[model samples]
Target: MKQVRIHGPDDVRLDEIPEPEPGPDDAILAVAACGICGSDVGYAKLGGVQGPAPEPVPLGHELAGTVVAVGDRVRGIEIGSRVALNPGAAGFGLGSGGPEGGFTPRLLVRGAGLGKSLFPIPDDMPFEIAALAEPLGVGMNAVDQVDVQPGEKVAVLGAGPIGLSAIATLHDRGVEDIVAIDLSETRLEIARKLGAKDTINPKNDDLWNDLGRLHGTEQLYWMDLVDTDVFIEATGSGALLKKAIERGGNGSRISVVALHRQEVPVDFMTVLMKQMRLQGAIEYPERFENMLELLARRDLGPMITHRFRLDEFSTAFEVAKSPDAGAKIMIEIG
Candidate 1:
């Protein structure tokens, strides 16, 4: 079998390796499409804890595949069945938790653990769309944490794939007043198309002042600009998180869904004054089914912006890193 490995920084090589044999409780999936996640680019650029580059690391995670082989203990799922692979087998972090965990041509996923996190890709679900279920699930989980209520005001910081997913999920949940803030105009445009009621280019306008201008009289009563009820920080920057805390209204819930690089300073005074609730969210614990169900029903075909071949993995990573790339980028493995 041919596989791509990150031998070091800026170094990705295609190598031949023996196909994996499924354990008694595992099944083998022939990769159909794999989405290049932001985390994959992070790994390629910063490497892992082991060294400067995650040597011998496979570089994908958002994926969908067909079950080609099954183990003795595997059941329910059968050969030829198309499935979305939940890249985080154990979890997302160090060791075997990150994208390096799912970038292979064939994935050996534990059968019992599969549906608990994975979902059967509907026959009509295209491989490219199916590959997005994982990150969409992440966005779903973040929104689930906020428990967005209908007609409530919502603010999503960041316009990356997950951020945009949050907007779509919030819209689906009936949140009528949605404000999306990002540094990139292109991403904000994508957010608007995805259902964000308002888009803010934080670089050009004073986000807080604009909020006051938009909601004038309401700003006094709302105070923290969170009169909108919920605030979601998906930028993965601690500074933005601190700002979200400062800008959130009293009793407002702020869900921290992005992973930051280091310890970010926060104003305890601001957190105390507003009595804000800050919660951190990781990959979906059990939201993949609901995400798939939503995708299966909605007209979200435009969310996928680009596609590339497995051999073009390096270019795929570069595109993922590019600021102009929009929505999800999928790697056509097969």
Candidate 2:
């Protein structure tokens, strides 16, 4: 079996290892496709999220595969069944006290704990689309937290994969008056294609001024008269969070979906004064099934922008890290 391993920062190597055998209550999956997530870039460039690298770990989580073999006790999911592998490992990547987390040619997954998260990929769903269920699940989870309403004004900060996923999720939920704000024109264009009603290049225009110009009098009630009802900050930059807070209206919900690599200052006094709801969102806890269902139903396909082969994993990572790279970057495994 061959797997991409991150030995250290900027030190990824493809290594061959023993093929995994499923234990009791486990299933071995043949990797079909895996999406390179933003977190994988952080891990590959900055060791790990909060600490140093734990092991020379295989780093992909957004994946879809087929069941090649199953353990004696595994049920419901049988061999030869096509499935989308949920690398979130039933919420926290713990995998019911299994071995370390990874993305190898063969994945040994616990059948019982997998639950609805490990969905049966529809025959109509392509491998590349199936690979995106995980990140779409993340965006779904964030939108679920904010509870976006139809016709409500929304602003999505940062047009990265997650941010664009947020835009897609919001659009799917029927929010038509959605605005995507980002510094990169490429990402903004991608966001617009994914149903963002308006795209703002933050570098060129003052966000509040633009909002006021677009929304007229309604924008004045919010910061500098920007009438945004729900604001999602996905940049993971503390500066963006603070700016979103300052620009949001009273009682508006601002969801923080990005993982900040370092701590930065925020305006606690302004939050209290404005009575804003600042919420922190993590990975999908219960939205994976719904996201998978949406994918299976073909409601979300515009977000997948690029695909590569397993041997081209480094190029995939580079594309993911590149500013010009659009939505999800997927690697074909099988």
Candidate 3:
């Protein structure tokens, strides 16, 4: 078997290794495809899973594959069945108990029970789309946190994969007034294609001034003057959070779905004055099915912009890291 190992920052190697033998309650998967997540880049830059490189670690979690070998205890799922993997059971990286992820040709699926972690997708779903179920699930989870009403305006901060997924989810729910805010014109264009009624490039346009055009109001107010009832901050930009607090409509909900490592200073008074509800969103271990359900109905092929074979991981990583790179970047393992 061949696996991608991160020995240190910017050091990734494809190494030959022994394939895993599944236990009675486990299974061995022949990986089909895996998506490169931002956290994987973090691991490469930090030299390891949690901190500096202490030992080699496997990277990649958003994956889908076929069950080549199944333990005797594994039921409901059968050999050669296509399945989408939930890496959340393991902390999503090598440092945690998560099975060495789908970056390898073969991976082990083991736990007290495999039901929650292994979701069977429709046989017709392409492996790449199946692999996307994980991140799309994340978007579904974040959107689920907010009670977005129909006809209400919504603004998403960031045009990354997750942010676009959020827009797709919101669009699916019948929300037509969506504004996607991002610094990338390319991403904003993608957002427009996905469902955003308007795309704002913070680099060129004043967000506050633009809101007036979006809502047809000079004074953006929560008292029906401002129509943005929900704001989803999908970027890790701390400044966006402050802007949401300062400008978000009264009683609007803000779903903070970005991965932020630093403490952001927010104006508590603004939050109080607006009576806004702010919440954080993490993994979508439970929303995989819902995500697949949504994917089943919509055309999500556009979300995937870059694809690379397992051996081309270095180039894949470079593309995934580039801001100009469009959306989902997948590594074909099989």
lDDT (CA) for every model shown? 0.73, 0.74, 0.80
For candidate 3, lDDT tens digit of each residue in 127-190?
Answer: 8998888788777778888877679888898888888889998899999999999887878888
Number of clashes recorded per candidate: 0, 4, 0
Q: Please list the residue runs of candidate 3 whose C-alpha ends up more than 4 Å from where it truly belongs after superposition.
A: 90-99, 216-227, 285-287
Pick the TM-score winner.
Answer: 3
Ranking by TM-score: 3, 2, 1
lDDT of 1 by residue, 168-278 (tens): 888887877889988888788888887888988878998877755553323434353546477788888877787777776777788888878789888887777677788
In model 1, which range of ten residues has the least summed lDDT?
A: 91-100
Which numbered prediction scores highest in lDDT against the true structure?
Answer: 3
Alpha-carbon error at 1 in model 2, in Å?
1.7
Any residue pairs clashing in model 3, and if so which? none
Cα RMSD of all models vs. native, in order, equals 2.8, 2.7, 2.5
